[model samples]
Target: MTASDEEMPKLLGDCVHCGFCLPTCPTYVLWGEEMDSPRGRIHLMQQHAEGEPLSLPMVQHFDRCLGCMACVTACPSGVQYDRLIETTRAQVELEHPRTPAERAMREAVFKLFPYPRRLRALRGPLRAYQKSCLDKLIRRTGLLDRLSPTLAAMERLAPPLGRTPRLPERVAARGERRATVGMLTGCVQGEFFPGVNAATARVLAMEGCDVVIPKGQGCCGALSLHSGREEEARAFARRTIVAFEAVDVIVVNSAGCGSAMKEYVRLLADEPTWAGRAEALSVKTRDLAEYVAELGPRAERKPLPVTVAYHDACHLSHAQGIRSQPRALLAGIPELTVREIADPDICCGSAGTYNIFQPEAAAELGDRKAANVRATDAELLVAANPGCSMQIAGALGRQGVDIAVAHTAEVLDASLRGLGRGSLVQRPQ
Candidate 1:
């Protein structure tokens, strides 16, 4: 069937119009409109499915959505909003073409992120921009005011780039281990926050799992696919499946990548040849925290006298429905007080490219999130997904707060090895 024919009914029929999802929806809360809520979106889809025309206003509401999937978790009717929103986005890209500048920016992301070689090549310029204070100076001077709102938004979300970490060819288990696992070093995370990957490797080794950093595993195609570049994302997905074919289990540290990898069967559904293989590989995929937690007896625990506030990454808590695993793992550590952030399930405005693509709304959400994090009065923030970690870290940094941000695996790893309590903290250079 054609794309349009396939998406209409799926998006229309998924929602039962239960108002249970309203309070959990960020956009719905911000707009206070049913049309902006999950159920409303489903209704819009139904209208379109019934041969009704989509108005420009209707499209605007859909575009404003962060697509965080909180509604999916909150829905009692089991609405498949993930599939609906994605299909809606694909429809938007096809039926409602973007302006030239917007199209150019989307093209740039697909060109740079999915291709490992291109991303590696661009690292030099990105690093230089960060180190020279050009990035900061532009924001400080409000130079972006001259650009379009979209470009300004993109500029604000660009983190201060750091040197990419070169992954070791292989890291063997410290003592006897039963199995080996390969890690998918993500595109942005590998380039900006290599230390997280390093920490993940160390933690896995501590748990008696040999860590393999397979070369040539490119971006997981999440950003591309989410932004409507399906064919390109599918190509990268195929490449990733081939690259890590030999590993016993593929561990992903980023919740976004983990969720995308877990959905590889659907992502590659059109490719009959690789559909089953993708499903098998996706089955073996585990979030780093989930993997570490499963190696339960091997995960050593020690007293950590710090208060840690855990922020749930959207992908982990909502998309993957992995709300309890990370918290349970954190609680396993002795002397570490695990406090929950108010609205822990709320999106931190870092919905992959959402921050860059929709800065005004993203910043508003970020500010609110930063306030919530501060209210916790915790010195350390723990999160599983790299995007959430970076976004929250950047937001905290911008507010001049001194709290340290880290992945859940990083904290667990430190506790397991009985290392310094502050080891998980991301120190400013």
Candidate 2:
């Protein structure tokens, strides 16, 4: 769907400068710059729409934003900062001509991140290095730090790649077939954290849903859409839509991917041919937690007997309005003590490659989030997104705080299968 280009200003006009979004905005909290805040960025958008050219100075503020959507949740006037930011980001990508180096970096990122095969290819080399102690040698000698901050941040953010589980084309429900749903084996989730996908299929099947993992299914355009590659995002969204047309629902384990797919109606609104199809796909998309929670926990949750602090992925909690579902799922586990960390609304600095681009600020936020998680004194930290898991786990590890970070689905899968506590921990670090 094509968004109203002129309505960009109208959306900006809806912001009430009451300072309600200030505290919730990550960049504003970091620099105290008015332009870095939600209203301030809206003002910039207003100016650009009027007649002023988009400048590097103006774009830097937009670039620093984590896009965590905390401001959208905090806004008293109910301003749609989420859509506004996305619109402005699309404008930036369209109007702004980045330098050769910056363009190359963006090209490198989009080229690698959205392709599972490319990521899989890198895993073999990375695994060998890690096993050969080259990773330790580089880190101990500070050789990794010698690389560009961005590359170093990417290095640190790398989750230990486990053996990728071969996903089945379909898994029939056990006993009774309640529903047949398509599962999105997303780029990073499929390649880097296949265990989560495997566990999700098991839990869903055990809960009486036949799960379908369509082969040749690619990225759902979450990462691309978030980064303002609008055309690239649309291409991927189209492919995803076609692949899962037969399913009753599309279950997404990743928070960002689900949120992006949910917005496909708006994303494709401009394409008359695909708009209706996109809308149909949007209505059927569900986060893994949302689907499982509403399904009423088909498999009995066994006693966990461990303390777990649940970290809210901004996209899940703030963007998708899925705050209670994941927590409720966790609470349903017998003998599981659920603990809430301080400043639960804050981003863990893992806003969909935000850490890769703005590593310094991302690191600071990650450290802050790690500290809060540490204060919870929980035995395991549960996060809903892969990026959050990697960012928080890396941050905690840097501080010498060793704790397990598990996906919510992984934890639930363990409980359903009656696995012990050790079987459930899937730390990104």
Candidate 3:
């Protein structure tokens, strides 16, 4: 092994061939394929560490993984599948040569999704397409599916275009300022679901936080890091670290960004120059629910009487161990009944860019998750991550389920302002 990958063997050895992760693994749960399971993937990683060639089939298994870190949560052995998979992916990108078609598709996704400006530029055209009802006509005909499944998944997963409001650089606390914090306006979250970021800022300010939003901040490299583009992820991490270095605490609304940002220490471990900064930033980074739960509620929550199913975003619940905070926050709203989805641990198949990359498997998982949500019979579905919201929304749309999906902050923001349920809950079109 090269010096860069010297840790793989030790990480690989941590797995004891346990079957514990199988039930929680989305791919394994879907297919029951041994290689698709976490233990099975670790077995492949072990073979690779011992000098076996990185074969295409083996790489496919890794790529099929959702990287939800549910396995990390399931493992009693405390195996670091998160680190192992990430390391293997970086190696895959370096050593393996993908077919031209797959490479081009991945290249397009990496190019468009990671750049905030590019995504923002898309808003105008996308809004026009949606407004003109052309998207509806095109989707109705299903031409995109025949053209490209990936593109079709993109179309299916696109959130309804709404008013894109500009967030202020700072939002002062409403009453007594308990703390000053910086917020991460993520690429997808900022461009597609601007409402979540707006609500995040408003909720934080209401909770007695002076929210600071640094200008020109883009992706935190969560997409790159999770997908195994190490250098690209590092560059984004560095930019983010520099952008929010002065803030006492960093708050993230999207679960994927929050989880990835919290792992900056490992992402930058090879670079001595950035190691300390990365660690410091990771230490301070918190999910909105996590931070808010820690800060406790200062603003009085007006009644938002509605039954809602809380879809646990894997990154928030499994990766960040934030299962209760969101539930608590939702529960705090008097008369708001929180119903639980059937398989709380299973992912909704929106692991960063996993839904786009592995559309077929993601679709199956999304379908399964949607069925469970349907069983809840709640008036609305609530999730923290935008990707989950979009994925679930798309699945529900496909299944003709009309339950609306809202972010936790959006719900809390509505309650704090004494707004009606219609203000926050929105059905994806």
Candidate 4:
């Protein structure tokens, strides 16, 4: 049975009410509300399991959870808070009703974010807006603050849009073919950060891997899955599985997308036909850093010669247990000083759509994370996940910090190609 089905109660029972999860939980740390913590949320889940109704208050607590899964990493008893919270969130999406405004806002987000074409269409307008001085005018006039916080958060989190270069269907390995891999050009990652995808393909090819990028691939259903839109997420997952069925191993760049793609086995467990296929795809799925690290770096690394603060995206760190691989990759480069950020375990508040939905709390958390990143005094910020990159960049921008944020793939790609440090690090204008 899936975690959302009969196994949910057992999963909930695993949490031992140990307070070890408290300090690591972003929401609990911010609010100090017991219900906001993992153990407290599990208590609420237990209450519902014991025949109590899933009340609005219970739903609110569940919504507050960033699903960062730091608690999953912290728990000594190996409590599966990740599965438990996902199941609970699914229940809330099904049983609870939000206000019309909330529903509309959520509807708008889902409609646009998951579809690659929709996001791609916005590239021209978004790029033009960034260049038109209107973006600066709105922010300078404090008009964003007067608008809805969600809109304000969206505006603030918009990365500097650039040319969206389309990737070819296949990139042959530069040398002897070591491995053939399929790449997931994620929805947001592809549209917002196309350079990262481009660099990923180049780096893979340089490392003697034939990169197969299926044109039909879209969202990995990460945003949907995280937000409890189970059916929508499954549909996306099913399509993704079929698109890359020919490839032996699937590689993902975005952390949240990677985590969700890896969870396809559980996400599609109830589906009779798709369950086995889901498991097959899940087994094949690997994060870009995780896959490259496992493949063993074959490409030459030139010196970057700069201090970089590596921000561990929650899904990468806790959901995927990919802490060292990225750092190890960076360490491979000569003269690359990897500075550790304070409170590395805490979420940057860009928990998928959490930053957009809970702007107030998200802003508070973002500011806190920004402060921690500043303390490192790193020249550049390197992150594996695009969301965390954007979140941290926006937060730093708010603080008048000009540090540039680059994906792990981008930095590695630069070093592999013998590009200058100026190629990777762009000081804000």
Model 3 regions lying over 4 Å from their true place: 1-4, 426-429
Error at 150, model 2, angstroms: 0.6
What is the alpha-carbon RMSD of candidate 4 to the true structure? Answer: 1.4
> Per-residue lDDT for 11-119 in model 2, tens only?
7778879999999888788879999899899899888878899999989989988889999999988888888777778889989988887888789999999999999
| Two-way TM-score contest, 1 vs 2, winner | 2
- Model 4: per-residue lDDT, tens digit, 90-194? 888778888898999999999999998998888888889999979989988887788688988888888888677889999999989999999999988988998
Encode model 3's per-residue lDDT on 211-282: one tens digit a residue: 999996888998898888988998999999999999989999999999899988878877899999999999
Which of 2 and 4 is the better model by lDDT?
Answer: 4
Candidate 4 lDDT: 0.90
Q: Model 4, 424: alpha-carbon shift in Å? A: 1.4
- Kindly provide the TM-score of model 1 when superposed on the true structure, using C-alpha atoms: 0.93
Please list the residue runs of candidate 2 whose C-alpha ends up more than 4 Å from where it truly belongs after superposition. 1-3, 425-429
TM-score of each: 0.93, 0.97, 0.97, 0.97
**Model 1 lDDT tens row, 102-158:** 779777766765566776787788778778878878878776867666566655555
> What CA RMSD would you report for each candidate?
2.3, 1.4, 1.6, 1.4
Ranked by lDDT, the better of candidates 1 and 2 is: 2
Tell me the lDDT of candidate 2.
0.88
Alpha-carbon lDDT, every model: 0.79, 0.88, 0.90, 0.90
